[model samples]
Target: MQAQQFEKLSLLVDDQLDKPQSVQLLKSVRHDPALQAKLQRYALISQALKGEQAAVADLDFADKVKQQLKSEPVYLMQRKKSDDQFKKTSLAVAASLLLAVVGFYAGKMHNQVQTLAQATTTAAAEQSPAEQMNAQFKEYLQAHDNVWYVNNNAGVKSYARLASYQSR
Candidate 1:
């Protein structure tokens, strides 16, 4: 009754259905006049198609079609070349941008280093040799204090005692 049953009838006429399915379909067709008529139509169509052939007079039809295809303009090929060139140009631009960023950072770091060096030289020139030595010893003691707290060892305790004596 459904469209699928009609399709099954067509397949049955073509002998394409399995034996059990074919026998079942034949039993249904025997009882149903409409199914028999549909099956007859499918068989006629199959016979007509089997008798049909290409109307071309010459055997060179395939060669002619091949020649026509060869002569046709392939726009996809041109577009692909353009796309490749665009990708290359984009890659070059990206590389240039990356290099510029790296160069800028490198230049900034160099300037910072130079500024620190100038500051150190100016500070050294303003202080006496004894004052500079005292300042250096104080800085060393401060750093040693941090290490003493972290280590909490007997050697660190002795070093801390000596540092306190020197600071006093």
Candidate 2:
């Protein structure tokens, strides 16, 4: 009548209960028609599982299923092939974009450095002869300071003559 009695009935059909419990459950099943019917169903299920009864399958069911599978279209396989190709193309495009970006920045930085070098060369070239000579004289004075004091008045006259020559 209760769920516990039904479970005891199943265990009894499987011969899983101990001797005393089996004896008690068997006595209950002897008096209960619903329990007897349940016991019969359990026995039928056990016989079907053991391949003693053909509860569901016909003889050609496996062959029919194999034939159906063989006749089915391979749409999933075709889609996987397309997906692989798309992944490869997407990776190639991403690599190309990365390379293009690196090359673009490299070219831009090279141009900036080249422009700076050119500006420095042009600035040096545009200096007047007097300014060039003055820079050279200052460098010489720094290197030989004892000579600067020895030829102080002569150095002033020579610098004046150099400036006049540049004007000419």
Report the number of the highest-TM-score candidate.
1
- Output the TM-score of candidate 2: 0.31
lDDT, residue 50, model 1:
86
Q: Which pairs of residues have clashing backbones in candidate 2?
A: none
lDDT (CA) per prediction: 0.78, 0.80
lDDT of 1 by residue, 53-163 (tens): 333234346679999999999775443367888899999999999999999999999999999999999989999999989777767867877545344453545553567
lDDT of 1 at 18: 95
Worst 10 residues of 2 by lDDT: 159-168
Per-model TM-score, in order, reads 0.36, 0.31
Off by over 4 Å in 2: 1-79, 82-84, 130-168
Q: Write the per-residue lDDT of candidate 2 for residues 126-154, one digit (tens) a residue.
A: 99999889878877876876454445655
Alpha-carbon RMSD, each predicted model:
16.0, 17.6
